[model samples]
Target: MAAETSDQYETLQIQYPPSHRRGPLPLPPVSRWALGSVLAVGTGGFLVLGAALAALVTLYVQGQAELREARTELLAAGAPLLPPNSPRSPGETPAAAQRRKDQLGRWLQGLALGWRYHQGSIYFFSSERKRWDDAQLACRASHAHLTSITSAEEQEYLARESRGGTYWIGLVATGPGGSWHWVDGSSYSSAQSFWAAGQPDNSDHGEWGRESCAQIHPVGNSLWNDHNCNFTFFWICKRDLSGP
Candidate 1:
């Protein structure tokens, strides 16, 4: 009877693998408060990042607006516009500013009339011809003097502007032995002078030292030539904007 009972009990018991549990497995206990905390932290981080970006954009826009206002103020102050790499204009007293404006207007008008401005001097080319003395008089009447060429650049410009015509300048042989000088009382320097080949041949060319005036000759490669002062020719005048 005992043997039969043990066999019956063993038949009634059943075995299953650990992974084959019938009902859903129990989950670990989770806190609702912790989940809410995590969500709040994440939301706050996103808000901070968005606020930072907005602040940066606002700063950039304000900076640009300030830069524009500064430029406008500078322009209103009568400051000249310069290149980015150029030096700023120096400050000037009210008197100095007025003086500069007075001179600048005249130079600008001369520029409008096709005159060339350089180093505070405005050069004008005459359409008519006149003797050297008469040309000097005309220039004085116009508040100017006969053009005095100081550098090779000036000579080249005058040559180009002359359009292959003769033009009288301010240089003359004023000294006893044909020493050249400029009309502004500046000594004529050979180093700065541009003379044509075999020029100023005064008496040697039968002028009897009468070729006291200098003229820009279109011939002989467009260089200076000593001509008789009485000869009528187109001339150039220079008005200095630099005050005494």
Candidate 2:
């Protein structure tokens, strides 16, 4: 009985290998809850990173659009990057705000040339020729009048620009036979006289009986001669507005 029992015990021990003998596993105890917590945290971090990237992309697109719009507006106004007297408001992006300010600055710079301000009368010299009456009528139509030489400087300017052409002036004779007067009714009291030798003779048959017009010649000096009103010459027209 003892031998049989020993053999049975040995067989039972052989069947259950020592390595397979069950007890506590050969690893340290692990908390399932802690492991799950770690996994959750890693997943949460990945999601957060993805969301942040998405937000950044959206913001970048919006910024680019706003910049494009600002550029277009500036170009349309023929304005520089900035303008004057521009105000900044809340919620404006940095680029958009800067663009508006630049446009304002440009406007200020052009104020002197009537770009953003009202300029006074402007004057121009016409190279076209017309009769005395026709010239006067043209000036009236253009909201201007024939220039009246009020000073020596003015006469000199006209003389230089006219280049010796017999230009019409605001002077005419009003007498029945030989009386002459300026359009402003001023008598011929200029200290500076620019007459050719043996002028005002009224000798020729060409309006000699009724010579009543002023002619300026480009004789390198601001000299003028009185002639008949019917003579045609290129005239200058002065406007009432200022130009650059």
Candidate 3:
């Protein structure tokens, strides 16, 4: 009976594989080192994937911020995202918003105040108390001088713009009723005199005698009056380059 029992046990042991043996079994290797290596490889792959995803996210955010800054600059320069006739609101679809922004950006590039290439000449207008000498000195510091109306066209243009205010011109009589000369040493012969009636009287004010300065005042008709230079009035300034 004992021999039969031993033989049966050996037969049962042959049917089942030993724990250390491996074949086409569903279970993996039981070695802790092997298991740890596999787990480490899996963790490393996961970390690499996480890093890639994080980089993608950062790039997306930076691109979005740059686009927003460009849009804001376009809007601040008096450019609107949508035209008055557009049938879209701020709450509209993404397509509509993008279209509006593009349209406005194109329009802003064509504005006159957008940018200037060159400025003509510097002109000045002042209300502060300054003698003719002082005024000329101030203009020189700015690399400019009192205005000189060189032609009839310029005179007419100035008369129209000056309106009714008395402003200084470059023409001044060095000697009583002498040849009028510009501050830049140019003769006044080129100018078409649009002086007001009874101008340059040079009335004696007891202190400095008659007025030595030349001024322009546009009455009902667009004409200028040579007044005392001592009078304070807002002057017009011209820049060799275009103005702001």
TM for every model, in the order presented, reads 0.56, 0.43, 0.44
lDDT of 2 by residue, 84-137 (tens): 345555666767677556544333332222221112222345566666667777
Scanning candidate 2 in windows of ten residues, the lowest lDDT window is 8-17
Q: Report the lDDT of model 3 for residue 112.
A: 21
Query: Which candidate tops TM-score?
Result: 1
Candidate 3, backbone clash total: 19
lDDT of each: 0.69, 0.53, 0.54
What is the C-alpha lDDT profile of model 1 across 1-244, one tens digit per residue?
Answer: 1232224223322221179879999988779998899999999999999999999887666545543443454456564534333443577565656554554455445555656555446678889878888999998876678888888887888888788887889988877788888886556789888988777666331333367888888766569887767657789888754432
lDDT of 2 at 185: 36
Stronger candidate by TM-score (2 vs 3): 3
lDDT of 3 by residue, 1-244 (tens): 1222223223221111158766776866579898899999999999999999999887666545544554465466543445535666656786756656555433233122221111223235565535555567766665556777766776666676666665666677777545577786555662356665655455543453455667665453645445445545445433332112
Stretches off by above 4 angstroms in model 1 are 1-94, 118-120, 203-209, 240-244
Cα-based lDDT at residue 211, candidate 3: 59
Which portions of model 3 miss their true places by more than 4 Å? 1-120, 127-129, 220-222, 238-244
